[model samples]
Target: MLYYAPDNASLCVRLALLALEIPFETALVDRSCNAQNGPAYTALNPNGLIPTLITPDGPIYETGAILLWAADQKPSHVFPAVGNPARAAGLAWLFWLSNTLHPTLRMTFYPTKYIDAGSAPLLLTATRANLLGHFAHLEAHADWLDDTQVSISHCYLAPMLRWSALYGTDQSWFDLGKFPRLLAFAKRFEVTHVADQARLAEGLGGTIFSAPTPPCPPEGSAT
Candidate 1:
């Protein structure tokens, strides 16, 4: 399998592949690198995004799609192909992350794309409020998202929370004290061997966001 990803959005999938101990080649692409928009990359994904997977079948985009495919290929641990209700619950968080939370955070951090950056202070404020509200929501229902054993939801959420820290969003927004279970879940996920692989792939020596800001925080967080 060939994986094409930028440093940020691709980290979770990279970690998942590592967790499965699947050997695959990695291709790094980005705007600074100008690789994602190149014809060579575009040929793989017309959407011109990173985290495109080229398998024996073909190329696949979208993080959730790539993740489900990876899980299906492994099928036992990464996913439960037996149609277990737990599997459905895990998949629900994957879709929620992809469709809801991710898009909201994207807009919060990329308001300049839709509005003038100079006059978009209210947009940023609104974005921050919405993001905090969503984080609070996640904190409230942390238990349902976890199992006696870890599931795919753990893999999907870590990267999103990491992105939140990268944007200078207060970790308090996650209500770590109130969401002790989620905090424990995150801690366990971080120390895994797969997370190590992702860090190495992303050229980080330790955790995904050990510093105040992550290398990538959407497009406008730093502006």
Candidate 2:
């Protein structure tokens, strides 16, 4: 498999595959250089998104979808098997993370994308409040939602928390300390080889998180 990852969105899938002991090569797409919009990368993921996995059959895009596919490749604690109640729960969390939580963070980080310049602050405030509500919901149900052994959501959530802390909003507003379980889950990956390598490769200067409010190019969105 050839993993086409950009700055940092690909870390989730890479970590999942590493946990499964899967060996795959990487084709780094330089989002900073607008590589994702280039003819080659766009041909792979028409959406011009980061982290497109090239499998023998075809390509897979989207962080959540790629993480799910990677976990399904082998039987492990990272994901529950099909038809199982736990599997159903996993799917729900993955979808929530992608559709609901991720979008909120995107808005918080890049509020300018959703509204006019003069009203960006108002949008950021409302969006950050809404995002905190989502975080509170996850925190309230952290026990069943987070896996001590590490799971697909962990890969997706950790970076989100990191983004929450670093984005247009400050950490004081969304204190990670309030979500101990989720914070711990994300922190576990911080010290791992997979996390460090992805961070360094992306020039992230830290853990596996891209620019929360990176400059706009001819394109928009880090996902």
List candidate 2 segments past 4 Å from native. Answer: 1-7, 144-146, 169-172, 192-223
Worst 10 residues of 1 by lDDT: 214-223
* lDDT of all predictions: 0.65, 0.70
Listing every candidate in turn, what is its Cα RMSD in Å to the true structure after a full C-alpha superposition? 4.1, 4.5
State the lDDT of candidate 1 residue by residue for 41-153, as single tens digits: 88988887667888778998887888888888877777667567667666666788788887787775567866896867777677777877776777776565455444555
| TM-score computed on alpha carbons, candidate 2 | 0.81
| Clash count for each candidate, listed in order shown | 0, 0
Q: Estimate each model's TM-score.
A: 0.82, 0.81
* Model 1 pairs whose backbones collide: none
